[model samples]
Target: MNISIHSFTLKLRDPFRISYESRNEQEALVIQLSDTNQQGQTVTGLGESTANNYYQVSIERMQKEVALVRERIEEYSLANEVLNAGQVGTPGHLWQQLQPELQHSSFTLCAIDVAAHDLYGKKVGQPLYKLWGLNPADAPTTNYTLGIDSIEVMIRKMQAKPWPIYKIKLGTPEDLAIVRELRKHTNAVFRVDANCAWGVDETIENAQELKKLGVEFIEQPLKADNWDGMKEVYQHSALPLIADESCIVEDDVAKCAGHFHGINIKLTKCGGITPARRMIREAQRHNMKVMIGCMTESTIGISAIAHLSPLLNYVDMDGALLLAEDIATGVTITTDGVHFPDENGTGVQLLTPSPTSLV
Candidate 1:
């Protein structure tokens, strides 16, 4: 077994902004794991992780963490030990073994977990979604994002694309105004994300106006840990609240029952598909809506998450769609939603030199 890490940079199609920060470009890491057989056949699995400064994991830091894990893999192999993937085992077991060593960096763990799933699926000659017996018809239409900008700019950006659902980024002084203006342009269903901008009272006030403007849901109205504030808004607001920063993993799913109507699961946030699936089930068990979101990543990451879209109620996995350039091929976005290729595993292929020959 062998693991290779490659760092890549992605430029955004437009300046991406949330409530707290903005960026023109993003740097991410791709991890590829493979094994050689007696016939010299090498099969590879690919995964990606975005180095989001908002998460306090910079590209440099993410690179270092992946290198550290790769070093550990080398050590284990030198001792002739059978690691989880070496024996066609589950990602959960590999996660448990690496959790202690990785210091619970969900981003790092996600890369490995996704790569393992990709490899396992390829070995079994099926995509991960098929392996899990998921139905693609169950997938909801993904929302195209309209980040915070001037009214004219926002309108222009919105007009540039055609989508059935649009997720608008709020947190500006003109939050409601932005929605009201955009509302005149398209009758498409809307989802608003505040990115932890408003106070409890303000959130409730904004929700009322947003509902009138035809918004479907409001995401992370207050600060992540502001449970009391969230509950206050949840009780008063007209719109359903979706937890973003507040819901990190499966453990946080049950806690969202009182404060939020739903939880947004990001692969990196929950440590890849293994825990992400668990998080989805946990959220459903608590009777809450489940959404799969993403950082601005490439097709490698978004494609990995797409495999699980069949199990989700909402999807915000347009990270790769927002990129100016993507070095891989995987999911395709349409008015209906994201569509995967017919290839096996995660159904993703790199456009560069290829992950299989990275060694």
Candidate 2:
């Protein structure tokens, strides 16, 4: 059994803007696990979104868990048992069986699942989606995001493009005025992502106000833990609510089942594709709609999500659309929506890191 880890920097195609802030580049960590079996060999690769302390946590955990997963893979190999890739319930149990010192690391638990899936995908020669029973042809239409900018600037940005649907970032009451002005420009089916910036009363009032302006949904209007407020807003507001920060982990879905009408599942927040798929299924079981989303990731991460977006109820994978230039290949997003990779596996092409100045 062997494990290796490497860190890479993913430069954004442009200065990615959101309700929180903007960034120019993203750093990523890739972990690979391998077992020595000349006749029946297995290898797995997992990537984590890099930026600030987020990757730091996953990277440190990956460093610690790589050896443990390697040992587990070796033991499984020796037992000659079929290593199921889509076995979600097994890993949770296996993690608990580990030593008490290694019991509570979320990153380790997440990395184990990712590695298992990657290895399974390689062995079966099928993409992750195929293993999960998703079709590439049925990819969902994604909404292009408009960052927190002046109404005029946002309008100009929209005018310069031809995206049918757009999502506006709204964090303050001032955004209400922006939405009002935006309504005068185009009648596109628009959504709002408040990013947990509003309170219960404010979200309720804003949703009511925006309802008349043809806004489609209000995402994460209140804080993640504000379940009572979210339920109150959901009951009284005409606008549909989508959860973002509130539903970070799969288990969190049950907590928000009645509070939000929909959830925005980002691969990073859910740890990776394995947990993300589980989250989608859990959301469906609870009758909550799904929105496939992304962090400020490059095409590698977005491409991974694009493969699964077609099966989701809503898609907000415009993270690459906001960039000025992309790493090229894997997935392509047109004004209409996103397109999945035609190749087997994740369909993400990792390009040779180039020397380019950050915008």
- State each model's CA lDDT, in order: 0.82, 0.66
**Whose lDDT is greatest here?**
1
lDDT of 1 at 277: 80
Q: 48-137 in candidate 2: lDDT tens per residue?
A: 354445334544454556555556544543112334642332332343344244434444444444444444444455666776687766
Off by over 4 Å in 1: 37-40, 71-88, 354-359
Clashes of each: 0, 6
lDDT of 1 by residue, 1-359 (tens): 58887877788999988899999998877888786433455777788888877789875676677766776554331111223332425566666667777756889889888887777677656777787889877888889999999999999998999788999999988888899999999999999999998898899888889899999999898999999898888889999999999999778899899999999998898888878888888888889999999898888888887889988889998888898988899878788767889876788888996333323
- lDDT for 1 in candidate 2 is 33
Candidate 1 residue pairs in backbone clash: none
